[model samples]
Target: MPDNGDLRDVESTPLQDTGVRVFAVPPAEGAGPGEIMQGFLEALTSDDPEYDTARKYLTSEAASAWRPERSTTVLANGPSITTDCVPGGREETNSATCVLTGTQVATVDAQQAYRPAGGPYRRKLHLTKNPENGQWRIDGLPDGVVMGKSDFQRNYRSVDKYYYASGTAVGATGQPAAVADPVFVRSKVDPMTQMVRSLLKGPTAWLGTVVRSSFPAGTALQKGVSGLAPDDQNKVTVPLNLKASRVAARTCSEMATQVLFTLRNLAPTLESVELRGAGGDRLCELNEEHAESAAWLGSARSPEYLYFLDGKRRLVRMPMRSTGTGAVAVPGPFGDGGRQLQSAAVSRDERTAAGVGNGGRSLYVSSLASGGSLGDPVLTSAGASPADRLTTPSWDARGDLWVADRDPHRPRLFVLEEGASEPEPVAVPHLSGRIEDARVAGDGVRIALVVAKGGKRSLFLGRIRRGGGDGQETAVDGLRSAAPDLEQVSAVSWAGGSRLLVVGQEQGGVQQMRYVQIDGSALDGPAPGALPGVKAIAASEDERAPLVAYSEDGVVRLPSGTQWQKIDKEGTAPVYPG
Candidate 1:
């Protein structure tokens, strides 16, 4: 991969030597405070599931209280540590405490969900000599572990866990609508146990509102087992408590499927997921065949072509599923008139499109295949200047069009449902600035809003909650900061059910693109590499799909295993089906 500098810092050197580390086993005895401190941090990057070896550095009391499962913090770099003798000289004059500090880059919770840290983190390590062994051991410290970002990237991995949407009735579609919430977990840890615990804990706060877990409330793993184990036959059994026993056979099977799919990526061994009661009775077994058959909760149905506007200011499409090139102007009334298109969004079905016209003063919709206008300006701005007018338009899976009328005096976010004469205003509670663009996820329950404030921009994730039932217009209940780490977010797109491909500049840094979870945690992987001079970007639910963007070279796409290739040398505003 071409070097693009740190995704979070353009002016700084990129972190190097990200290969997996080989940690030496801790000393059998006589290790000092400094040695223990180093061993402890190294253990965070080790492949040990339970960190059994790292416990040797701590006193018996401290070891029993430390819980590495509480969290895994990714620091900007290896922490700086300093030690000094305790002022009052106890029985052992060599007794001392160590102070360590580092900038926290991100944090992964016990559920494995990743969240970027907002500031620096500091830790204290108190140590005393183990009189019996004459070894300086840690007597007190923080509960969890911390490691450098580069080391964290090499040791951790991002995985998705499946959950069904909330509003969908069970079995409405042979496959219930499923959304994937991505989380980061240690690659060598007992990932199966982590995945199970995450599933039982339900979705993260941001996703909790839109998706529901199959596991029952208060369901938990049987105590006394620190990690899961597989039988000689390779069948891994999951032991659940009594709360899960209340579920019906079919419900239990669905729950098993959730665990099946989530663990499928982590452990590809040959077998099934057997859900067991606390007493060891089998509740249900979800084999590979059964998991494969339950496809309702997933998404892989996007169109094969990416839609954009050609040099002639006309709507066009190019094949995305192939290595082919060239663009075909979609049959439509757009770009046919003296009209000039700014930015546009294609509906999830690819049947219709919403476009910003006349320098963002008006919004219009037209049929893509039928070649006709759906209506006269679905929305128009009363603002005077072009910058104070409407922004790009986007469509959600529910067939509703979303746009922001950035009238300086009356900035508003509006949603236009099919056949609605006037767009209904969607309230964005506690908006810090003017709305620049709005893109709704394919699930139709969340929206990614870019707000410009104080000469800078930031991205926020919001839930789409409708008030009136039936055919009433729905509104955005609230928006929460999605990528609080990115100080000047320029563009964003839903890369997966739980992850977003965000292009933004870090505070006082150059712009770059990275995959970030809705909870504001950057993925513990290599940067998507930089898109030089990129203006906008779009991605599909398939993480493997090539990203299409508009740059100085015109509409371009970074195809797999290749550099950016031009689709239309003179086009702008490239977009894909959400």
Candidate 2:
């Protein structure tokens, strides 16, 4: 079964139509050999956990030194290549990476959004050979969800006899045995208080990505600029570096509840900025009368909004809506919604302004002080279309905007609201793959959660229309995607109206920022273990706060607690516009 598709446009890559296949090749006839090692541990848990198909059946250096990012280093256990293979080792072949040590099996637990729902992962597999095609296959495993080796050697011999008999506690109370040794999961952080602390509220916005290399161009001190942030020890910028320069760029703006970062360098067209609470600034400097360009910018009230980008960035209906009296009418992105402005929302009594694209998909509401556009583009319709990748929208209280459509690889979620004709989508139930985040608090009730690309997930809170009606979601209770297990939970926010603020990873890969407190029950009792990427994350209904920003080389601040504070006296990456 070799057809995992898209392996460089088909040329033999078949891993059986995608869910990847082919494991145990030695078995000659009637099933047995533990059903060929349970179909070679279900083709090493589906696909691409990348051991490059277990180094083509492990041509061994003791199985790439038991590859788990190499470290712990081990080997020796060779003889048990057991797929039960009877008949004189049923046609053995040895070192095809010793089948990189095959082992896997977890039929279901739809990868609890990547760890936390029913928690349990230990999968470790391998088996390769295909030096371009001899065959064998299998490979890699544990991106989470393993359990099968006689139920993981009976839950690792009852957690190695409750942490070696008395040296510690499973639930704690007098104890004392011995024989421990096989311990794993390493991101720890649960001394007792956790269940995602009610999603602990307030302060959000942390988006930094600037790698450039060389130095000069417009050098705002980039290569390793941290300005401030020390404890949350994302190491205040671990070995942070950024010197090259393709004219850095990265944007984000909200104003008046703050979040106005726009570092742009387009070669000589300057615009540097740095503001979490507000610090580094220099808003503009483009030449030939500034044609810099406007990738994006939001906010239309508190402190003003609309700056799509000069010579008509469009959508300017703020406290500046004047037209008749003193005169001041600049509004152009029209809306009978024949579809023009693909994104923009302004209701909360700013009258109304919604969108979905031009040529009419529907979801438009206009009237910035009786203006011209906004007659349609408010909610568009027809067979579900308008979804330009939505990074983060969140409208709620019945206005319905809620847009965290992140989709990093099919990580689902979408909602438009108003009269409800199309935008629905929500499938996050046991989450399937990649989302990095989804926040929606305030009056949406709660939805904060961080998804994964490979386990380490926690900080849930569910409920907004969930219940038993198909999407099957009820209790949310979080705090297992690990905090006590150390740290990983990627990103989450809602910090007020019920609390919820997460954004994780501690110890080495760094970046730790907590603040959970949503009262339901952090996923009840168990289910913790999650971690992956995403370094910063924010969310704020203006102070309903939920921010966990971080950068490397320098700059850390974990807010919910009292330590970690450095506005980047070091950390780089924030040059802008990427």
Quick one: best lDDT, which candidate?
1
Q: Tell me each candidate's TM-score.
A: 0.81, 0.24
lDDT tens digits by residue: candidate 1, 108-138: 8876778777587888788878667677888
Please give, for residues 199-312, the per-residue lDDT of candidate 2 as tens digits.
011111110010111122232322333332222311121111122222233212111001111111011232232222112233222222111122111111121322111112
Question: Best candidate, TM-score-wise?
Answer: 1
lDDT for each of the candidates?
0.76, 0.32
* Candidate 1 TM-score, C-alpha based: 0.81
Clashing pairs in 1: 116-521, 175-296, 178-297
Worst ten-residue run, lDDT, model 1? 168-177
Error of 1 at 59 (Å): 3.2
Query: How high a TM-score does candidate 2 get?
Result: 0.24
